[model samples]
Structures are given as structure tokens and as C-alpha cells.
Target: MNTYLRILSYARPYSRFVPVYIVYTLMAIIFGLLNFTLLKPLFDVIFEQVDSEVLLSYQNKPDFTFSIDYFTHLFNYYFLQVAEEYGKMGTLFYVCLIIVVSVFLANLFTYLSGVVLAKVRAVVIKRMRTDIFDQVSRLHIGYFSSERKGDLMSKMTNDVQEVENTIVQSLRVVFREPATIILYFAVLFFMSVKLTLFTILIIPISGAIIGGITRRLKKKAVESQQSLGRIVNILDETLGGMRVIKAFNAEWFMARKFDEETDHYAAVNVNMARKNELASPISQFLGVTVVAGILVYGGSLVLSGESTLGASDFITYIIIFTQVLNPAKEISRAVSNIQRGIASADRIFQVIDTKSKITDPDTPLAFDSFQKEIKFEQVSFGYEDEMVIKEVSFTLSKGKTIALVGPSGGGKSTLADLVPRFYDPTHGIISIDGHDLKELSLADLRKHMGIVTQESILFNDTVFNNIAFGMDEVSEEDVMEAAKIANAHGFISEMEHGYQTNIGERGAKLSGGQKQRLSIARAILKNPAILILDEATSALDSESELLVQEALTKLMQNRTTLVIAHRLSTIQHADEILVVEKGRIIQRGTHTDLMQQEGMYQKLSSIQSV
Candidate 1:
């Protein structure tokens, strides 16, 4: 219930529609009830059973008041007037005309209320989906690593879709169905109290049974939605790793995994369907039993002359009572659908409710530029009890270069990540220009630093857009200039559309060197005070390496640089070189200074020279 109400709360300004919708709905219900109630008079005109004394009494109109009695009496006053003026045939036509008008008004107001609900439905979904997207965007970088990409995608797409289909559609059913049943029963009781009371008792019994069944359906619904998320996860992994699957000939392996999830999804849905499907048949069967019981009980009253209801009035009561049954069945079905919708809602809220582990402080220090050196003091970081960076400390001053060369998993990249505060250290302080990184807002802390990783992160956009990414109001001339400095303008100018060419997903259309240079151009465009190049030219071929390395050198000029390199030649001219091994700085000195000694730096230099 909490989740269901939370979804409704997104429909802000409910005052815009709720009151008007209630009015339209009530108008529809009251007029619709008149249709059933008119049946009593319809029989009177046809059978010539209108009591002369009763007809005469109705001739004098009742004073109007805000009660059902006023409308009932007003309708009879006009009804008997038509009968007195004409014979039974004319009276019959009058009654038919009134019924037709009531039907028309009922349908017209129902449509008006539907329009209001449609607007609410559209607003509810738009806000709900937008909220999910915004929350996901603001989540810290680590959350993406710990959660499945496809499952998150499922919550944004499939889960929102489920709520729209089931919960939003139930808005009308939730409101109108119960109101219709309640009003219809009000009239039913007015005509035959004993019969209406008997149905009232039976209704709760059916409701209890249906409620029990739907509770179990909610559990199955949770399982079903979860299984569907895994199916999407498998599909995403399979699509993303098709190259690996084919290379390893693991087609059957992926197929087995996909098939298993789908099979489970199908089985769970079948179980849910069995329970959900059971509700309608049970409600309908119970409705029929109630109808039959009313006949035996109410018919005996009419024949024995123990009830105030005449034969015509009793028949009218039964007809109106039958209309109540349809809404009852709909209510049962709506409850089943709501269970599924709430299950999906729970999944969506799980993501939206997650508090980001990393956020800006309540009172952040001001930092617009890097004036001095960045210092790391006894910093350590770990992932779940296994330390990856331990007691690592280093300093890189303005207008200088510091390079970290190490083996894979030596925490070089992790150390670089700490500079940008991608992940805060588990212990110790990292201060920039005498301000601790945590004391500055993330936006201020990262604004003056640009990072170009080993893998160039390019979106599926035009070259100009990619170069100008994260910055607005960037003129094309500026983008072209930055590209020229990064050695990217040459290739971009030669393309079909030049800078306007749309690179495919992750720059799939571009070569590795081309992609790297574009990323460097993006960093250059930012003109950040500090640049972290994580082995920027390591993936390029010999010819492309020379081009990308030149661009890196240009981008690094007059800026503080923290570099991670696998190749020894790339950082040979660095102001200082750090040899990192097993999460610690094993050696630190100038490249030539380290080479003069017998160390990992000399050994690595010798191995690469071979």
C-alpha cells in the first residue's frame, strides 16, 4: 500500500482533477441508477398496474430537497403526468425516451471522467520515469560497478512499463468500480433491505477468499519480475559480448543460460496466472449464487405478501442488483493487477531510494583552480577487505610531470582515480592546493582536472560534439582548434562530414589511435589545470603511437601531469618516476636516477629494450 500511494503522489496538483472527476463519476452513477430504477415504472405502464390513488398522489409534486427521495418523487410526478395525458402506448414511449436520455448522460460523463484519468495517467508515468532516470544519473560511480547494467535498464524500462499498464489503468477501476457498487447497493437496499443484506454478507466472504489468493500472487509477481530482469541481463551480456562468445565458441553456453532464465520466468508467470485467473471465476460464480439466493428469498416475500416491495419493484431490485455484480468482478481483477504493479514498483523504488555513498559536503570549500601541488598522505583503499592501494603517498607540483609505471593490478590506475576523488581513500588525506579533496565540492574539485584513460570513452556522437562534451556554448572554431592541437583535426577534416560525422557507438567507426586523439582533444578543449593520462598511447600501433604521443605531449605542456604507463619509453623524460608493485611505491626517482640503480625500473627498461 505504501508503494502504491508513493506512485500516486507523483501526480501532483491532484486538486486539478480529483474533485471534478468525483463530480463526473457521481453524475454518471446517479443517472445510471435511474436507468435501473425506471424499470419499476416501465412495468407499471405496460401492465396497467399503476394504483389510481398512488398515481393521483404523485400528481402533486414533492418539494425539491437534496435527497434521493426528491429525485424519486420528482421522476414519478412527471411520469404519471405523461400516463394521464396519453394511453399505455404513449406512456411506454415516454418511459423509453427518459431511459434513452439517462443512458446518454451516463455515457457522456463516463467519457469526460476518462479524459481526466488519461491526463493523470500520462503525468504519473512521465514523472515516474523521469525520476528514475535522474536518480540513476546522480548515483555514484561505484554503484554501476556493483549492480548489473541490464537489471538497472530493466527497472527504467520494463518496470516503469509494468506500472503504467497495471497500476495506472486501475485508477478508474479503483475509484469508479467501488463507488458504482456502493451507490447501486444503496438503491438495492432501499427496495429490498433483507435481500441486500444477504448479498452484503456474501460479498465479504468472496472478498476474503479473493484477497487470500491475491496475497500469494504478489509473492509470485515479485519472483516473476526478478526473473524477467535476469533475462534482460543475460540478453544484454550476450549482445555486448557476442565477439567473445563466438571467439570462445560459447554460443551453447550463453544459450543455456538464457534458456534457463526464460524457462523460470515462464513457469513463474504460469503460477501467477493460475492464481490471478482464479479470482474472476470465483467472483463470477459467487455473484451467480447471490443472484439465485436473492430470487428464492425475495420471490417468497413477494408471493407471501410479507414485504413492502410489489412484484414490479422486486424485479427492478434484482436487475439493478445484477449490475453491481459486474463492478464486483472488476474490483477483484483490479486487485490482482495491482499486486503485480506494486511488485514492479518495489524494484523501481529500490534504485531510486539508494543513497549515494559519495556526495558533496554540507559546507564545501571553494576551489576554482589548482595553484600548488596535490599531496597524497598515507592513503589506502580497499574493495571489501582486500586492499588494492596501501599506504601510497605521492606529490605532483604545478607545471611538472610524475609517471607511475607498474605491472597489471599494481594499483596504478586506482591511485590515479583517487586524484579525481572517484573513490575516496579508506584512510588518510589527499589535499589539493592546501585544501583536502573531501572538503571541496566534487564539481569544484574535478572542474580543473581532466582525465584521458587507456580506453578512450567516446559516445556515439559527432566529432565536434564529442570534443565539446560536458561543455556548453563551445564554438566550432574552438573545437577545431583543440582537435588541431591534439593531432585530430587532420583525420576529422578528411572524413565524409568532417567534424560533423557521427561516430558509431563508443566511436566504433574510428580507429584506436583516432579515438585516443579525439579523447585527448576533448581534454585539451577543457584546458584543465591538471591532466591525468592513463597510458594514453599504449593501445596504438607504432605509427599511430608516435602521433598520439605527440598529442599527449602537447596536451601535457604547462600543466601538472600524473601518468600511468606500461611502456618504459613513454615516461623516460618524466621529472620523477615511481615504480609501483603490489599496491606500494617500491621506487621513486627521476627515470635516469632510477635506471642508474639495480631496481624494477632498470629491469623493466632492460626487458622493453630487448
Candidate 2:
């Protein structure tokens, strides 16, 4: 329940809709009750049972009082006057007219109340979803590596949708249902206190039964949501890896895996439905049992002439009491469904409550320019006790290119990752121009660096938007010039829409060389003071590699560049080369100097030459 209330707190500044909702709800309830209360006078008039002397005494206009009897007498006094002035048929028409008006006004106010609740529902969902998305965006890159993408996607899409459909819709049931039951009970008590007290005593039996059924529903609901997330994960992986599955002829394998998860998900929901569906009928049966008890006990009292309840008033009491059962039944069903919503809320708030491990420091050092060099001093990093980079130290002076050549899994990419603070070092310090990287704001620090990975990470967007990504107010000419320098302008112009053409997902519409060239164009447009290239040309064909390599050369000029080279021939002219092996730098020197020594760099160069 605390989690449910916390989710609703996102609907702030309730002054706009809450007060109006309250007004309309109250008006609807009052008029709806009047529809039942008017039944007493209606019965008395039809039976011709009005006492002339009593009616005459009430003719003096009784003073208004808080008791129900005062209002009843006040209504009867006017009714008797009309009864005397007109015929019996005229009085009947008059009473029927008032009932019709009361019914119409009751429904009108009910509709108005619904309108207000709709507005509140929209506002709450909009604010809650926006906050969840913002928190997910701010999380550190390592969080994604550890968490499943589909699970996070479920929190954003499926879980949020559950809150809207079940929880937000229940907001009215939370308030209006109880208020209706209470108001109807008040009318029942006014007619006969003894009968109302008897009804209240047995109501808890229904409550206890309903509570027992719904108590275990929350646990089941959580399991159901988790199973659904797993199903989503399977679907997402299958779609993303469709080509792999087909190439390996493993469609049956993938289909079997998905079928197992979805079957479990369907079974969980079936169990939940069994529990949720039981609450309504069980409560309704209990309500009918209570009504039967009232009929026996209250009917005996009137028969013995020991009770003041008239036949007409007793009938009205039973009518109002039966109406009370409807809201009670609705409340029971709502409690069952609310358990499902609370389960979803727990998943959503779990993500929103998570604090990002990477955040800006208070009073962080301001950094706008990069000068001199970037130095790693005895730097070491590990992922959960297994070291990837061990006490490695190097200095990358400005406007010079330093290349890292190594066998696979030798921490070349990990070492490059440290420069942008993607993962902070476990042991030592990395500084830029004499200032610690941790002391500067992350955004400001990253502003002067550009990165291109082995995978060409292009979006499904127009060529112009992809090149000018993350930048604001960039001119078209500037984008064109950058593309031209990266040698992408020729192919881009050949497309049907030129720069405005929509590239399919991850630039699937373009060739390998075209995609890499666009990536280089993006890096060149940023024109950062430092560049990190992680095997950027290794994935391309020989012809594609040549074009991409040419573009990379244009991007690397006048920048402090860190190259993780897979091909030894590409980095032979680097100002300095470090040969890394098994998380340690085995050798470091100029390319020519390293070639003179019979070491790992020489062996790797000889193999590539073959």
C-alpha cells in the first residue's frame, strides 16, 4: 500500500482536479440518495395513509434542523397541501416528476466526476513515465552490461502500462466506492438503528473471506510480471539475432525456448485470474446471506408491533441496504486487481529508486580546454576480482598518435575505455593536463573527446541527424563539409533523398564502407581534442577498409589519438606503439625501434605479412 501511494504522489498540485472531483462526487451521492429517500412519501401518498391532523400541524413550516425527521416532515407538509389542492392523480404526477429530475441530476454529476478523474489519470501517468525514462537514461554504462535490456524495457513499457490500466483506473474506485457504501449505510441507519447495527456485525465475515483470497495474490502477481519480462527478453533476443538463428538453422531451437517461457507466463496469469475472479462471487454470496438475515430479523419485529418501522419504511430500508452491496462487491474486486498494480509499481520504483554509481561531484573542477597531455599513472582496473588492466602507465602528448597493438583480450579496449571514464579505475589515477579526471564534470570532460568503436554505431535516422548527433544548431553546410572530408559525400549524394534519406535500423540500408565513413564523419564533425579508435577498420572488407582508413586518417589529424589496432600494418607510422599482452604492457617504443627488438610486436607483424 505504501508503494501504491508513493506511485500516486507523482500527481502533484492536486488543487486543479481534486477539489472539483470532490464537489461533483458529493453532489452525485447526495442526489442519488434522495432518489431512494423520496420512496417513503411516495408510498404514504399512494396508500392514502396521511393523517390529516398531522399534516395540518406541519403546515406552519417546521424550523430547519439537522435531524432527518425535520426534513421528512418539511417535505410531507408541502406534499399534503398539493394533495388537498389537486386530485390524487395530480399528486402522483408531481411525485413522479421530482423523482425523474433527481435521477437525471444524479447521473449528470456522476459523469462530471468521471471527467475530473480522467484528467488526474492522464497527468499522473505522464509524470510517472517521464521520471522513469529520465532515470534510466542517467544510469551508468556498466549497469546496462549487468542488467538485461528487455527487463529495463519491460519496466518502461509493460510495467508502466499496467499502472495506467489497473492502478490509475482504480483511483476512483478507491474513493467513490467507499463513499457510496457509507452514504447508503447512513440512510439505512436513519430508517432503523437496530437493523443497521445487525448488518454491520456480520459484514466482517465477508471482509475476512475476501482478505484471505487477495493476500496471496500480490506474490502471484509479482511472479506473473517477472515471467512476462522473461518472455519479452526472449522475443527481443530472437529478433535481434534473427540472422544468426536462420544461418545456423536453429529456428526450432529458438522457438522452443520462447514457447517454454510464454507457457510459464500464461500459466501464472491463469492462476492469478483464478484468485482474482473468486473475490467477486464470494463477496456477493456473503452479501445475499446478510440480506436474508435482515429480512427474517427485521420482519419479525414489525409483525409483533414492537418496532416503529412502517411497512413502507421497512421496504425502503431493504432497498437502500441492497444498494450498499453493489459498492461493497466492487470494492472487493478492486482490492484483488490492486494487488496486481502494486506488483508492477514495485518493479517500476525499483528502477526509479536506483542511484547511478556515476554522478557529478559537488563543486567539480571546471574543464573547457584540453592542453599538454593525458597521463595514466599506475592505473589498474578489474571487473569483479578479475583484473583487466594492471598498473599500466602511459602519457599521450597533444597532437600525437599512440597506438596499442595486442592479441585479443589483452585489455586494449579496456584501457581505451578508461580515458572517457566509462569505468573508473579500481586503483590508480588518470589525469588530463595535470587535473584528475574525477575532479572534472563528466559532461565537460567528455565534451573534448570523440570515440568510434569496432561496431559502427549508427542510428535509424537521416544522414544529417546521424552526423550531427548530440549537437545543437549545426548548419547543413557544416555537416556536408564534414561528410565530404570523411569521403562519405559521394555515396550520400547518390541516395534517393540524398542527406534526407532514412537509413534503416543501425544503417542497415548502407554498405559497410558507407556506414564506417558516416561514423568517421560524425567524429570529424565533433572535431574533439582527443580521439579513441577501437579497431575501427578491422570489421570492414579490404576495399572498405581502405576507404574507412582514409577517413580515419583525416579524423586523427591534429588530435591526441589512441588507436587499438588489430592490423599491425595500419599503425606502423604511429609516433609511439605499445605492445600489450595479458593485461600488461610487454614493450613500448617508436615503431621502428620496436621492430628492431625480436619481441611480440615483431612476431605479430610477421604473421600479418604472411
Candidate 3:
């Protein structure tokens, strides 16, 4: 119940719709009850069961009162007058016309209530999905690393969609259905209090039976959602790594893995469906049994001549009581669906309630430009338990190019990531111009830096848009100039649409060198004061490498550059080269100075010379 209410609280400022919906729904229920209430008069007239004494009593208007009896008497008084003034056929037509009009108003108000509820559903979903997405966008990069992309995608898509389907469908059942049942039961009690009391006593038996079936549905629902996430994860991994799978001739292996997960997902859903499906039939059977009991009991009372329920009124009571089953069944079904919705809501709120570990301080320090050096003072970082970077310290003054040469898993990338505040250090302060990085707003800190990685992350967009990715309203001349600086202008012009050509997903349409050049172009357009290049040209061919290296040189000039490279030739000209091994800087000096030392740098330089 708490989870359901929490999910509903997203729909705020309900003053616009809730009151109007209440009025329409109440009118709908009242008129719908009127449809059943009129059945008694129509049956009495059809069977000619109206007593002559009762007819004469209805001629003089009964004194009006607040009770239902007063209203029934008032309607009967007018109905009998019409019958006497008109013929029997005319009275039949009059009663039928009233029934038709009541039915029409009932349906119309029902539709109006549905329209209002739909608007509320749409607003709730829009706000909820937007809030989930907003929280996701604000999360730290480390969150993505620790979580599956497909799992997150499932929460945003499948889980949220589940909440929409079940919760929105249950909304009407929660409000309108119970209101309908209550109004119908009120009429039943008014018709025959003894029979209504007997019927009410048996209703809880159906509820208890249905409740037992749906009790475990929530736990199964959670498992179903989780299994679906794993299936999505498998699908995503297969699609993203199709090249690797085919290259290794692992199609059968991938197929078997996918089948295993899908089989589990299917099994989980089957189990959930078994429980969910059982609730309806059990409730329905119990409802029919109760109705049968009511008929037998009420029939005896009428046969014994001890009840005020006339033949037509008893039939009307039975009709209205039977109508009660529909809403009761819907309520049972809604309970099952609400359980599923609560499970999905748990997953969605987990993401929304996640507190991002990386956030700017409440009172962040002011930072406009990089005037001095970036100093890492005894910085150490760990992923879980293992320290990846230990006591790492360095300083790169303005306009100086420093290269970090290291083997794989040597914390080069981790050290570079710290500069952009991707992950805060575990145990030290990284200060830029004597101001701690933690004290600066992330946006202000990253705005002055640009990064180009080996993967060359480019979106599937036009060349112009890709180059000017995050900027707003950039002029064409400026974009073209940035392309020229990155050595991408010539090839872009050679393409069929020049700057407007659509690059396929992740720049799939471009070659290795072209993609890297576009990445460099994007960085150049940002024109940050600090540049971080992580093996920018390591994956290209010789000719492509030369072109990309030239672009990098242009981008690195007159900037505080931090380069992480495996190729010894690329960093030999850097003002300083740090040889990092096992999370510590073993050597640090000018490239030539490091080469002169009989250490890791010289050995690596000698090996690359081969």
C-alpha cells in the first residue's frame, strides 16, 4: 500500500482533474444504480403485480423525507399517475423511456470519468519517466561501470512500462469499481436488509481465498522483472559483441546462453501467471456460490409470506446483487495487478532514490580558467577493495605536454579519469591552481578540459552536429574551422553530403582514422584549456596514425596536455614523460632525461625500437 501511494504521489496538483472525476464517477454510479432501480417498476407493470391499494396510496403524494423510501414513493406516485392518465402501453413506454435515458446518462458519465482518468494516467507516467531519466542522467560514471547497461535500460523501459500498464489499469478499479459496488450494495440493503446482510457475510470468504492466491504474486513478480532484465542484458551483449562472437565461431555458444536465460524468464512468467490467473476464477466461483445461496434464502422468505420484498422488488434485488459480482471480481483482479505494479515500482524507485556518490560540494569554489598547474597531492583510488592508483602525484603546468607511458592495467587510464572527476579519489586531494577539485563544480571543472579516447565515441548524427556535439547554436564557419584544425575538413568535403552527411551509429560509416579525427575535431571545437588523450592513435594504420597524430599535435599545442600512450615514439617529444608501473610513478622527467636512465622507460623504448 505504501509503495502504491508513493508511486501515485508523482501526480501532483490533482486539483485540476480529481474533483471533476469524482463528480462524474458519482453521477455514473448513481445513474447506473437507477438503471437497476427502475427494473422493479418495469417488472411490476409487465406482470400486472401492482396492488390496487398500493396504487391508490401512490395517488396522494407521500411526505418527502431524506430516506430512500421517500424517493421511491415519489417516483411511484408520478409513475402511477401517468399510468392512470395514459393507457397501460403508454405507461410501459414511459417507464422504458426513463430506463433508456438513465442508461444513456450512465454510459456518458462513465466515458467522461474514463477520459479524466486517462489524462491523469498520462501525466503520472510522463512525470515518473522524466524523473527516472533525470536521476539517471545525474548519476556518476562509476554507476554505469558497476551496473549493466541493459538492466538500467530495462528499469527505464520495461519496469516503467509495467507500472503504467498495471497501475493505470488498476486506477479505475481502485476508485470507480469500489464506488460502484458500494452504491449497488446500498440499493440492495434498501431493498431487503436481511438478504443484504446474509450476502455481505459470504463476500469475505471470496476475498480471503483470493488473497491467499495473490499473496506470493509480488515475490514472483520481482523475480519475473529481474529475469526479464537478464534476458535483455543477454540480447544487448549479443548485439554489441556480434563481431566477436562470429569471429570466434561462438554462435552456438551464444545461442545456448540466450536460450538458458529466456527459458528461465518464460518459467518465471508462467509461475506468476498461474497464481495471477487463479485469483479470478476462485473469486468468481465463490461469488456464484454466494448468489445461489442468496436466491435459496430469499425465495424461502417470499414463500413464507413474512417479507416486504414484493415479487418485482425481490427480482430487482437479485438483479442488483448479481451486478455486485462484476466489481468484486474486478477488485480481485486489481489486487493481483497491483502486486505486480508494486514489484516494478520497487525497481524504478531504486534508481530514483539512488544517491550519486559524485556530486559538487554545497559551497563549491569558483573556477574560471587554468592559470597554473594541475597537482595531484598524494591521490589514491580503489575500485571496491583493490587500490588501482596509490599515492600518485603529478603536476602539469600550463602549456606543457606531459605523457604517461605504461603497460596495461597500470592505472594510467584511472589517473586520467580522475582529472575529469569521473571518480573522486579514495584518499587524497587533487587541486587545480591550489583549489581542490572537490571544491569546484563538476561542470565548471570539466568545461576547461577535453578528452579523446581510443574508442572515439561519436553519435549517429550529421558530421556538423557530431563535431559540435554539446555546444548550442554554433556557426558553420566555426565548425568547418575546427574540422580543418583536426584534419577532418578535406575528407568531410569529399563525402557525398560534405558536413551534412549522416554518420552511421557510433560513426560506423567512417574508417578508424576518420572517426578519431572527428573525435579530435569535437574536442578542438570545445577548445578546452586542458587536453587528455588516452592512446588516441594506437588503433590506426601507419598512414592513418600519421594523420591522427598530426591532428593531436595541433590540438595539444598551447594547452596543458595529459597524454596516456603505449607507443614509445608518440611521447618521446613530450616535455615530460612519466613511466607508471603497478600504480606508482617509477620514473618522471623530460622524455630525453627518462631515456637516459637505465630503467623501465629505456627498456620500453628499446623494445618499441624493434
Candidate 4:
């Protein structure tokens, strides 16, 4: 229920449609009742030989009492009256005709209302998907490092679709179906409240049973959704590393692993469906029994001739009762769907509700230009368990490059991430030009730093758009200049579409060298005051490395740069080199000086040379 309330809050912006939807719902109900109510009179006129004066008067009456109401009702009366005039065969003909017309009009308006309701659902779901994407984009970087890409995709795709289905079904029941139950009950009650009361008693008992079953189904549904997310995550890992799996001959192993997760999903689904599927058949069975009980009791009452119910009235009750059955069944089915939607909602809301670990301070410093220095004062961090950076500190003078060289698990990358506030320091502080990093707006802080990681990030988009990603309203000339500096323009010009060529998903269509050059070009285009290069040239061959290195030198000039590289040769000429081990800075000096000191840096550099 709480989950549904949260989902409905999104519809607040479209509240104007609520009244319009209600009006349409009422019209559908009125038409449905007219469709059923016409049945009994036709039966009576044929079998009981009813009065012709009454039938003819109803056929042509201009009484203020009936009004035109609409052509459907008027035609319904006319068709029934004609049957009364034309004998038994004519009654059957008109009866079939009325059924066809009512069925047609009922279906026509139902379809129209469904289309309108779909529009409402589409708008709501679109807004929700947009909001979820925006939240994912804005979250702190650390979250993605620990989060599974496929699980997040499931939330956006599968989970949201579940919610959409529930909304569509719930609207039909909440709006249209309730109106049906009420209209039919009013007709039944006017005919005989004792019969109505009997049905009411039967309905609540069936509902109670369905409702209890639905609650258990909801628990199983939540488990099933989580299991499905795990399956997606495993499949993503398997497909993403198919090459590695084949090299190790692990196809059958992965297939077994996938089957395990899929089997768990199946088990949970079976549990949930066992309960939910019970609602429809049980309600149908109960409806049959109730109708039978009513018929037996109603017949006796009419035969006793002690009440208002005659043969016509008894037949009307049966018609209303049969019609009421469907709405009752629908309401139970809708409740089951609502429970499933709530399960998906819980997971989606979990993502939406997470507080970003890194957030800008309430009152932030806005820097016009970065000049003096970027400083880390007693910084420390950890990824859950062991500390990765501990009480380490450094200062980068304006326009100087600082290289962080370290053994594996030495926190070199974690330290670079701090400049953009990707993860807040567990203790102490980091500042740019005397203002704390956390005290600057995240967007403004990131605007000053450009980063390139070991994995070259590229979207399936035109080369021009990739270069211009970090900037707003980048012109063609700006893209050309950045590509030129990055040494990417020459090769890009030779491509079929030049700057307009689409880089297929993650630049898969481009060569390794081409992708690296484009990454450099994108960074160069941003032209940030600070730059982080995490082994940016590690993936390229020697020739590609040489080309990328040349571009890196040009891009790094006049920018405060932090470089993390396993190839100590690349950072040998940096102004300063800090050798990290465990979570502390074990050595800090010029590369030549570190070599003279014969420390961890010297040992690693010697290993690389050998």
C-alpha cells in the first residue's frame, strides 16, 4: 500500500485528468447496466406474454421521466418493444440484435477508455524512468564500483515494467470495475435487498481468502524479483567475459551456474503463482455456488407470493448477480497484481532512496579560477574493510604534474578520485586553492577536473559529440582544435564519416589506438584545470602508446595533473613521484632521487626494466 502511494505521487502533476477519467468510468458502468437490465424484459415479453400497452408506451414515450438518455438506451427500449409486437421468433431476433448492439457499444467505449488510460500510464512511467536515470547519473562514483550494471538495468527495465502493468490493471478495477459492482448491486438491492445481503456475505468471505493468499504471494514476488536480478548479473558477467571463459573451457560451468540462479527464480515464481492463481478459480467456483443458492431461495419466495419479487424481478436479480460476478473476480485479480507491483516498487525505491556518500556542503565556495594549489591534508579512505589510503597528504602547485606510482592495492587510484570528491575522506580534508573540495558544488568541482581511466569510456555516438561531451554548446571548430591537439584529427579525417562517424557501443567499431586518441581528445576538449590519468596508455600497442603519449604531453601542459601508471618509465620525468605501499606514501621524491634511495619504487622500476 505504501509503495502504491509513492507511485501515485508521480501522478499529482496530472491530477486534472482524474475527474475526466471518473466521468468516463461512470459512463461505462451505466452502459454496462443498461446492457444487462434489457435482458430480463425481453425474456418476460417473450415467455410471460406481457402487456403490449406498456411495451408500446416505452417504445415511443416522450415522457420527461425517461428522457432520451442517449441513443443506446432509447434503441434498447425500442428493440425490446418491437420484439413484444412480433411474436416468439421476432423476440429471439430482437434479443440477439440488442445483445450484439450492447456488446458492440460496450466494447467500443471500453476500448476508447483503455486507450486514454494507456496515455496516462505512459506519461507516468516515462517520468518515473527519467527520474530513475537522473538519480543513477547523479550518484557518487563509489556506488557504481560496488554495484552491478545488469542489476541496475533490471530495475530500469523489468522492475519498472512490472509497475506499469499493475498501474494499468489497477486503474481498470479501481475506476471501472467498482462502478460496475455498485451499479449492479443498486439494481439488485432495489429488486430484493435480502438477495443482495446474501451475495454481500459470500463476497467478503471470498475476498478475505483471496486477500490472505495475495499477501503471501507478495512476499514470494519480492524474493523472485531479487533472484531475477542475480540471474541478470550472472548472465552479464558470463557474456562480458565470453573470451576468457572459452580460453579456460568454462562454458559448461557457467551454464550450470546460470541454471542454478534460473532454478531459484523458478521456485520463487511457482510459490507466488500458486497463491495468486488460486484467486480466479476459487472466486469463479464461489460465484457459481452463490448463484445456485440465490436461485433456489428466490424461486421459493416468488412461489410463496409473500414479497415484491415476481418472475420478472427474480430474473432481474439473476442477471445482476451474474454481471456482479465478473467485477468481484476482477477486484480480486487486481489485488493480486497490486501486490506484485509493490514488490518491484520496493527494489526500485531502494535505488532511489540511497543517499549519495558524497554531497556538496550547504554553503559552497565558487572558484572563478584555480591558481594557488590543490592540497590534501591528512587524507584517509577505505573500501569497506582494509584502509587503502592512510594519513597521506600532498600538494600540487598550479600547472605541475604529480605521478603516483605504487604496487597493486596501493591506493593510487583512490587518491586521484578524491580530487573530484568521488569518495569523501574518512578523516581530514582535501582542498583546492584554500577552499575545501566538499565545499564546492559537485558539478562545479568536476568541471575543473578531467579524468581518463584504464577502461576508455566511449558511447555509441558521432566522434564530434564524444569530443564535446564535457562541454556545453561546443562548436565544430572547438572539436577540430581538441582533436588536433590529441593527434586524433588526422585518422578521424580518413574515416568514412570523418567527425560524424558513430562509435559503435563503447567504441567497439574503432581500433584500440583510435579509441585512446578519442578519449584524449574528449579530455583535451574539456580543458580542465586538473587532470587524472590512470594508466591511460596501458591498453595500446607500442606505436599507439607513442601517439597517445605525445597527445598526453600536449594536454597535460598548463594543467595540474595526477598520473597513476604501472609503467614507471612514463612518469620518470614528472616533477615529483610518490611511491605508495599498502595505504601509506612510503617514498616521495624525483624519480632519479627515488632510484638513488633504492626503495619500493626502485625495486618496481627495476622489475619493469628486466
Among these predictions, the greatest TM-score belongs to: 3
Considering summed lDDT, which 10 consecutive residues are worst modelled in model 4?
Answer: 63-72
Quantify all predictions' global Cα lDDT against the true fold. Answer: 0.91, 0.90, 0.91, 0.83
| Model 3 C-alpha lDDT per residue in residues 88-178, reported as the tens digit of each score | 8878898999989999999999999999988989988999999999999999988999899888999999999999999876898978899
Runs off by more than 4 Å, candidate 4: 48-105
In model 3, what lDDT does residue 332 have?
Answer: 95
Off by over 4 Å in 2: 65-70
lDDT of 2 by residue, 1-610 (tens): 7998887788778789878988899889888888988887788778876667767877877888998789878877778778888868777777888889999999999999999989888998899899999999988787889888888888888988888888888888888888898888888877789889999999999999999999989999899889888878888999889999999999999999989988998898999999999999999999999999999999998888767898888888888888888889988988888899889999999999998877888889989899899999999999889999999999999999999999999999999999998888999999999998999899999999999888889999999999999999999999999999999999999999999999989999998889989988999999899999999999999999998898898888888999999998888879999999988999999889998999999999889889
Please estimate how well model 1 matches the true structure, expressed as its whole-model Cα lDDT.
Answer: 0.91
> Which prediction has more favorable TM-score, 3 or 4?
3
Better of 2 and 4 by lDDT: 2
Of 2 and 3, the candidate ahead on lDDT is 3
Q: Please give each candidate's TM-score.
A: 0.97, 0.97, 0.98, 0.91
Clashes of 2: 0
| Candidate 4 C-alpha error for residue 442, in Å | 0.8
Q: For each candidate, C-alpha RMSD in Å?
A: 1.5, 1.6, 1.3, 3.3
* Residue pairs in clash, model 1: none
- Candidate 4 local lDDT, residue 173: 82
